[model samples]
Target: MVIGILKMDICLPHLHSLKDKRKVLKSLMAKLRQKFNISVAETGGQNKWQRSSISVVLTCNDSGFAHQVLEGVVREVENTIEGFLVKYEIEII
Candidate 1:
């Protein structure tokens, strides 16, 4: 099995508090989970109001497919999310 992981750092410039952060993050997480069938969560920057780190994991039979899926997910996040991307990394194991 091929395991793909994606880590994203994002900035919510318009957010005012943790509550707003949760709202935005929860919506993005739900969209990604529903659309990609991947496991995702907030992995870092939990106490910060404007910054967040999120992780997504997937299992596939081939490495190329795994990479492709995560790449697509990144684009989806960049396009659909209310916040802006700070940085991202991808790994296959």
Candidate 2:
């Protein structure tokens, strides 16, 4: 099996509170999970209102497919999310 991990550091310039952060993160996570059929969560920066770190995990039989899915996830997030994607990394193992 192949395991792919995608980690994203994002900056939410418009968010003013934890409530706003949670709302945006929840929607983003839910959308990613449903669309990619993978696991998504806030892995860091939980206490900060304007910064977030999100991790997405995918398990599959093909590494190429996993990488492709991760790339698609990144594109979707960058296009649709309210925050700026500061950086991202993808690892396959």
Candidate 3:
């Protein structure tokens, strides 16, 4: 099996407080889950209001397919978010 993992550092510029951040993250996460089959979560950056670290993970039987899925998912996430993105990294194991 091939495992794909994606880590994204995101910035929510419109958020003024932790509550706003939670709203944005929860909404985005719901949309992501509706569109993809992977598991998603806020894995880091808990204390920062504007910054969030998200992780997505999934497993597939083929490496090429897994890579493609990860790429597509990452792209979708980047395009869907209203805020700026700091960085993103993907790994296949």
Assess each prediction's global lDDT (C-alpha) against the native: 0.95, 0.96, 0.88
lDDT of 2 by residue, 1-93 (tens): 999999999999999999999999999889999999999999999999999999999999999999999999999999988878999999999
Ranking by lDDT: 2, 1, 3
Please write out the lDDT profile of model 1 over residues 1-93, one tens digit for every residue: 999999999998899999999999999999999999999999999999999999999998999999999999999999987779999999999
Candidate 2 lands at a TM-score of: 0.98
Over 4 Å off in model 2, which ranges?
none
Q: What lDDT tens digits, residue by residue, belong to model 3 across residues 1-93?
A: 889998999998887999989988998888877788888999998889999999988899988887888788778878888887799898999
Give candidate 3 misplaced runs (Cα > 4 Å).
Answer: none
lDDT of 1 at 61: 95
Give the range of the ten consecutive residues with the poorest summed lDDT in model 1.
77-86
Question: How well does model 3 score by local distance difference test?
Answer: 0.88
Point out where model 1 deviates above 4 Å: none
Least accurate 10 contiguous residues by lDDT in model 2:
75-84
